[model samples]
Target: MTHELGHAVHEYVSKKYGELGREKSCAQAETASIFAEQLVFAALLKAETDSKHRFILLAKHIEEMIAKTYRQIAFYRFEDMAHIERTNGEVSAQRLQEMFKSVMDNYLGPSVDTTGVEFICAGIHHFFEYDYYVYSYCFSCCVVNSLYEVYKSGTVANFAEKCMDMLTDSGVENYCSALAKFGIDATSPTFWQDGMRLFEQELSELETLEADIMKRTYINLEKKATH
Candidate 1:
């Protein structure tokens, strides 16, 4: 609901798009939705007192982030290659499966055996829906994470207000210009890396929580032993 509300809010607040066309590019759309999600997640994290619950929340969010970024990127690559290969000739089902397996192997590395996972391509509806656009998911994830970092940094003055202004202007300004409102440079590789750091930060917190939970469990055991 929050994610949909984000999209609705963007369409409503952004005056530049007018009535005829009120939507952002794929990456831009995800940016708004994911940012709204971040807001909700932040509120939930703030209220939750249970360490285990906090760890679960972080773990789920990080898992979703990985799917949105890394997995989508891999899908995008497969689509790109599939499109290029299609021009040469009709891609046989077997050939497409082989292609899909190769792409997945490249992305997954040697960590997991993809052995007979060619069916994955046919299952993904996006591959049938578009030519090659899944990369936008990864792009938007990085962009949103980077923005969230800025919000948490305390360096930016009136960060939330500026962010709203930027969203309102998204209909008019391209991503580079829209992000520039926060002094974010999309051209810089660091901009994307900054976004990845959000994942890193969460994972670090989860690690700390794991240790704390384990220690508390051991201390409780010792107390029971004494009693």
Candidate 2:
């Protein structure tokens, strides 16, 4: 649903501004899609009444954020390292696997058993087919997150229309120029942090929910035992 909205917005915008360029256009579309997903997720969380269901939703949101942001950043770093190593000398398959494992472990952390996961890199077609493709996920997530913050601030009176206008202009103007109209400065150092803050907030909420759910479960178990 989110991706399609991105396409639709892209199409709608492109008609007005013309094709900006492949990379910028794709980035703009991705930004729209990710923003849509965040909005929908927020709406769903708000509507959910059951604690267990809300916890599930929150968990899924956190998982998705981690995958899109941290994991993709890890992949980007791994690719950078691999490319640099290739330039220095021949990187053996074993060495590549080791590099992949190191980066994966960095992102996945100690709790995630990454045993036998190194080989999985061989299956990732993007590593071969697309150059730095993983970074796009990170880029889009950050852009959308910053834009979503603007929307939530209630400062922009016509947020939807402004977004549409931004999309329309994206086809002609560069992403930074187009986003600037909506007061989003992608080049700012804080821009990425603005995006990351959304995930942090979601993770914090999820942690609280998990603790509450565990407490309720413990209470129920104790009640049953006593009865």
Candidate 3:
């Protein structure tokens, strides 16, 4: 539903502002969809009272964050590296795999065993289908995240109208220019961090929630055993 809204809004905006170039349009559309998902999730989280349900939502949210943000960024990095290496010489499959694993490790962190995980790199068809397409995911995620922060802060009155204006502007304005209306400078090095911080905050909340849930389960089991 949220994704559809993105498309609808994009269409509406495109009609008024003219169609954006394929890449910018995709990025804007994706930004709307991802932002919609975040809004829906936030609403659901607020209304939910059951610990189990909350935990499930948080887990799914975390998984989505990892996949959309970190994983996509890693893929982009791997693609960049692989292309650069290929220019120097013919990059062997093994060399490509090493490059993939190294980038994956940087994002996945120490907990994930990336050893012998070369097969996962093969699963991404984007490298063969299109050049540098994975970067859009990272871009969209970060842009939407920054936009969400703007909405949350209530710094901009008439936020919805501003968003509509942005969507409608289409390709007339570059992403950085479109986002500038909302006071977001997408080119800034700190811009991506704004998005990342949202994920980090959610992960911390999930950890705390999980710990509470575990404590409750232990207590219940102990009581049952004693009785």
Candidate 4:
């Protein structure tokens, strides 16, 4: 919910303020999604008697969200890179389909059934409106994950007020610059690596839960494999 609200703010800023406004809005939107996920997940865990169970459930759901975000955005990144490499703007839809298909297969893994659905290059909402909007989710997730780490650690040093200020200044700078205030340099490979590390951290928590607890909380892991 907060995530979508952030996007709403982004749109408003972009339409009203232009490039700088758009960048700030995007950063705010990204922050919204990232922080909200953590806050809600933590609350859920605290509320559950089976903390371990809730942990795994939330972990898996978050994993799927993160994976999907990366998968979709990765395709956007590839497409953007391709456009940059191209000499002209005359690429065919069929060509785009083929490229997108490869990306879907690569990131979707092989577990979830795709069956006869040609979802790869069909009906993507961003296709018509946002050229590389999918990547924004991935980028935002990375920033969010990093920010959550600081916020949750209780070491952010006025992070709450700072984040609020960041949101209000949504149209003043780009995502990277906004994140920079938090001491994060999004352009570095370390930034990405740190984001990926969160998945590992989540997975480790999942593994511990599975090893000692999930059977007690969940009833259908094997049958509902996706869950």
lDDT of 4 at 197: 68
Better of 1 and 4 by lDDT: 1
Which ranges of candidate 4 are over 4 A from the true structure? Answer: 6-27, 81-93, 109-114, 174-177, 214-227
TM-score of 1: 0.87
lDDT of 2 by residue, 1-227 (tens): 77688667667655753444323545666777787788888899899999889989988888888888888889988899999999989999999999999999988889999999899889888899988888887899888888888888888788898787776666566778777876878789988888889888888888888899899999999999999
lDDT of 3 by residue, 96-143 (tens): 889998888888789988778777888889898878778777778888
Residue-level lDDT tens digits of model 1 in 1-227? 99899888777778666854455577777788889999899899999999999989988999989888888888887788888898998989988888888888988899999987889889888788755558877898899999988888787899878877777777667789878878899999989888899899899999999999999999999999999
Q: Which candidate gets the maximum TM-score versus the true structure? A: 2
- Higher-TM-score candidate of 1 and 2: 2
Cα shift from native, residue 111, model 1 (Å): 4.6
Q: By summed lDDT, which 10 consecutive residues of candidate 1 come out lowest?
A: 15-24
- Each model's lDDT: 0.85, 0.82, 0.82, 0.66
User: Cα deviation in Å at residue 28, candidate 4?
Assistant: 4.0
TM-scores for every candidate against the unseen true structure:
0.87, 0.89, 0.85, 0.74
Every model: Cα RMSD to truth: 2.4, 2.2, 2.6, 5.9
Name the TM-score of candidate 4.
0.74
- What lDDT score goes with residue 15 in model 2? 72
Clashing pairs in 1: none
